[model samples]
Target chain A: MRAAGRRAPALLVLVSVLLIAADHWITLTPLRAFGSGVYGSLENVTSSVTRWASDARRLETVERENARLRAEVLTGRRPTAAVAGAAAAYQVVSAHAIGFGGDQTVTLDVGTGSGVARDMTVLNGDGLVGRVVQAGPSTATVLLATAPSSSVGARLETSREVGLVTGVPDRGLLRLSLLNADAAVRVGDRVVTLGSENMRPFVPDVPVGSVVAVEGTSGALTRTALVRPFAHFSTLDLVTVVVGPGRPGDGAPQ
Target chain B: MRDPARKPAGNPAGRALLAVALVLLAPVAQVSVVNGLGLPGGGPDLVLIGVVTLGMVLRPMAATVVGFAAGLAADIAPPADHSIGRHALVLCLIGYLCALVPADSSAGQRTAAALGGTLGGALLDAALAGVLGDESWTSVLGGLPGSLAWTVAGGTLVAVALVSLLPRRRRFGGPASRAAARGHYTGGHHA
Candidate 1:
């Protein structure tokens, strides 16, 4: 028994290392799927506990969003042509944020059954949330916009200058990079997604956030800025998944 | 004749069952209650607390198995990123290292051990992931302080509670117990 005890820990360590190597090399699809299923059930139980409070909070948010949209329309800052086109082209699938994965990811209630595929853009009333990384039958894991591995192409609304927006995990802010040093970007400039090919990941003109600060002195080859994402990731309750192209015959004036 | 020191301290099957329960419960609570608490980055890792607590009580080999199981549960838990087994490797080392501390250590000492294990585990996990190119330098640097603070705070609480709650086994007619009786008989003369 004494000898066995000494060898047990070493054996466990060895097995763990091998498992890690295998997970890295191959997609453990069934295991991952089982995990997702269990996670979804737990999320449901927990979500129900906070359902009333979340509903109240969600109501406040909806009212606020309605007021903001009304103000935008009154101010003639309504959706641009590209934004309108994208909106008309994509159908939205509503989902609730059931749980979070680690520091930089969230799990949504909607998944493959709801037509949520990998790389589908997810957003809420506030703004961009993230993109779907893994889709199970009933659950989807979203890689938040502010995750360390997450990066999005964004363009300044005013100057149309483009850059890559990456997550600053520590600061909970998005860092915009690869901008020209002499670009006319300023504090409080609106940032929106530049969209991706076929709109698989991001759709054009989706509200990202506003620039908070630009790093580095002037005349550098490239500049970076901190962006305050409109989506309050930590408090996400409800979100929308951009499923796919909208109905073909429902074209409205762009 | 069996040596008392070599005998397992508790029911092996019971300990294994307890370890399995902690492994399952920790991650669920971590994602649901802890994360729901609205911490900025995320809640302190509850799974690490369970592993560290077990390490302080269980034998080295048992602790290692528990740690590996806990880490595997964490890897499969939702929101888990990077490759699986990364957490397992860190935790296995932590469990083995923590078991080296004497089980009868003072509460303060045990608390320190738990704190060290958690902080060390988090750092080692990050370092290993960074080496594998799974994590960036900035992310690791940025997250370390907050992770340390929360883990220490949580670990200290768990250590204090566990130390007080765990039953102390007294061997019948053992020298330590006899010494205590002798002290009492001498009207605290040993003092």
Candidate 2:
């Protein structure tokens, strides 16, 4: 028994090393999916608990926002046509924000069973949240726009100047680049998604963020600006997944 | 304090069950509550702390098994950025090394050792990530100290708790007391 005890750790370590190598050589999709399912369920439970704990504060915030929005509507400042287009064009699947993976990824309670698919866009009431990278049967993973590898086509709402918005993971900020130097880009300019073909990954005109800083001189061939995303990546709670071109049963908009 | 050389006494099955429970719950807490606590760099690695604490009390082999399972659970847990097993490999070594510490060591000493182990594991993880080209050397190195600090703080707390709660018989005194009692009886008979 003593001898066996001495050998146990070595054997287990060896097994762990081999498992690591195996994971790299092959896609452990089934295993990974299973793990995700378990974690996702646990996350769902925990998120609910946290949500319940903060219910009163959240309720007060919501009420204040609702009153502000009502005043905006009464003042004849209705939402733009682009906002309306987004609302009508995509089927929104409501989901609870479960947990974040590292700094750039988040897991959601909804998944393939709820019409979530890879590359589907995720959003909240404020703005864009992320895009789905993996969707399991009952859970999905979203790669936030703030990840180092994430990039989205964006246009300045004022000048309509198009550029690419890429994430700076270390700084927790997004940078917009490749805009024409002559473009009327300035501080506080609203940025919106340029959209993709058939709206698969990103739908057009959804609010992305605002320019916080403009980089380079005025006459350069191209310019870049730092953007602060509208959605609070750290405090995400409820979000909507844009499943497709139309509402679930509407069978794709013409 | 109990004798360090004594074989530990406890229900192996109960201990195994407890290990499983810790492995499952540690990562969930790490992801949900701990990570959300908004500590700088990230939350302390609760799973790593648990492994180290267990290592200090359990036999080397048992501790190692617990470490591997806990590490694997952490790897597969959501928000894991690197390839699976990086954490497992690090924790396994840390557990084995920690188990080698004398069981009779003071709880404070054990906790300090666990903190050191947590720091070492965090650094090893960062180094591995750098070698794998998953992250830049600068980024990995930059984040190492802060991560280490957090893990150490967390590990210290966990070690303290484990030391306080584990049965003294299971941890240090059982087998040695029995052996000593037997020796005393034989000597008296001979006298």
* Top-TM-score structure, candidate number: 2
lDDT, candidate 2, residue A235? Answer: 81
lDDT of 1 by residue, B125-144 (tens): 87887776777887777777
Docking outcome class, model 2 = acceptable
lDDT of each: 0.77, 0.76
The model with the greatest lDDT is 1
How close to the true structure is residue B93 of candidate 2, measured as C-alpha lDDT? 86
Q: What i-RMS does each candidate reach, in Å?
A: 6.5, 5.9
Give candidate 1 regions above 4 Å deviation: A52-88, A178-181, A216-218, A248-254, B1-17, B100-102, B105-109, B167-191
